[model samples]
Target: MKVTRLLGSGVELADGSRIAAGTVIWTGGMRASALTEQGSGQRDPLGRLHVALDLSVTGAAHVYAAGDVTLAATDDHGNHAMMACQHAIDMGRYAGHNVAADLLGLPTMPYQQPFYVTCLDLGGAGAVYTEGWHREVKLTGADPARSVVA
Candidate 1:
């Protein structure tokens, strides 16, 4: 597959085709460009580089966040998991129904996604279908699956 990793404006290929200075156009697969913040126009905000994000999964579990304060927890309940869409859907349902019940003194709906499936859009490259809370991650490539549907 033809891929172009553009780390910088300067193009250099360790192997494969390399474009010339006067080349009209160039193309390649772009993964992650340098993490430059918007407006700042630099990888770091100020002259002092803050460095990488310290992800402490253990500490994250004990601390709970709501609304826009969601963070990643690595090992909550023996499975370090994402605060993802699945969790969002569950949270929405629970929060909405609970609020409604509280207002009218009715029974609040319990929120639990104990048994469910996951569809991960791997950036249109492909997707992974998994059982449980990310227990198994499988890529559906060209073949997709072994058995043909009847």
Candidate 2:
């Protein structure tokens, strides 16, 4: 049921089937790029490289991975980083810092993002905003829209 393209009124599936509708909301999934295969490291089912606390590739020396390519622990509660910009941005920052720190012979900091939030657009119905990994709904309907504008 993979979506190959989003039509003006609907979506086209990978099987070449098309569905017509008035609205379509696509929350695409993520997968690591082919470049990750070139590295010698353990990969998750999604092909994300298993990374150390310092964001370094687990089995590759001096090589670091970040963003959607690496699967790093987000916190001590066993939550791993997702392949989203929210996690990727912070992962990139930590990876950059750790890489420089490694080269300079300085202690590198562990990557940690304890807080998580999600804002999902519902098209004409407005949006939904949630906080934390449990996804506790903080706002809905036009409230999320107003908050975004404000």
Candidate 3:
């Protein structure tokens, strides 16, 4: 659902429906910043630059992209990193290490995250926890509460 506008305590949808709530958490998704357009490189549909394993911009020498600005391979099984905080955090770390390694003539490590997990909060109904790209449910209700609360 696309939000047409943000109300005082909720959101108006594109279809002209209004939802009332005490709090609204919008996870509407994101697009890469226009700063990426200033550079020359292949970009994904979201405008993220396609990056090499070491987080360097493909076909753009000495240029690196990470975080939400990059489209990167996450593992050998052909999984790609998503534009989420979880992926961005690790990508940032890898980009930092790889950039320093390249400058100091050290071997750079390829970015890889084979394991994936997700926790979705359902508010008063509690939450759900899943694993893998397919989002296989591994926990729910009290299980997620116990695992995520800490």
Q: Please, what is the TM-score per model?
A: 0.38, 0.87, 0.84
TM-score for candidate 3, please give it: 0.84
**Candidate 3 residue-wise lDDT, 14-122, digit = tens:** 9999999878886667999989898879898899998888999999877778888998999888899888888999998998998898889898888888888889988
TM-score, ranked from best to worst: 2, 3, 1
All candidates: CA RMSD (Å): 12.0, 2.2, 3.1
Model 2 TM-score, 2 decimals? 0.87
Ranking by lDDT: 2, 3, 1
Query: Residue 38 of candidate 3: its Cα lDDT?
Result: 87
Tell me the whole-model lDDT of each prediction, alpha carbons only: 0.38, 0.90, 0.87
Q: Taking the tens digit of each residue's C-alpha lDDT, what string does model 2 give over 10-106? A: 8899999999987786556678998999977899999999999989899898899999988999999999998898999999999999999999999
What lDDT, from 0 to 1, does candidate 3 have? 0.87
Best by lDDT: 2
- The true-versus-predicted C-alpha distance at residue 67 of model 1, in Å, is 6.1
- Where is model 1 more than 4 Å wrong at Cα? 1-81, 120-125, 137-139, 142-150
* lDDT for model 2: 0.90
Best prediction by TM-score: 2
Q: Per-residue error at 114 for model 3, in Å?
A: 0.8
lDDT of 1 by residue, 38-133 (tens): 123222122211211122112222111222122322233443223356654555555555566656768654334455456644433655566676
- Give per-candidate clash totals: 4, 0, 0
User: How much is the lDDT of residue 91 in candidate 3?
Assistant: 90
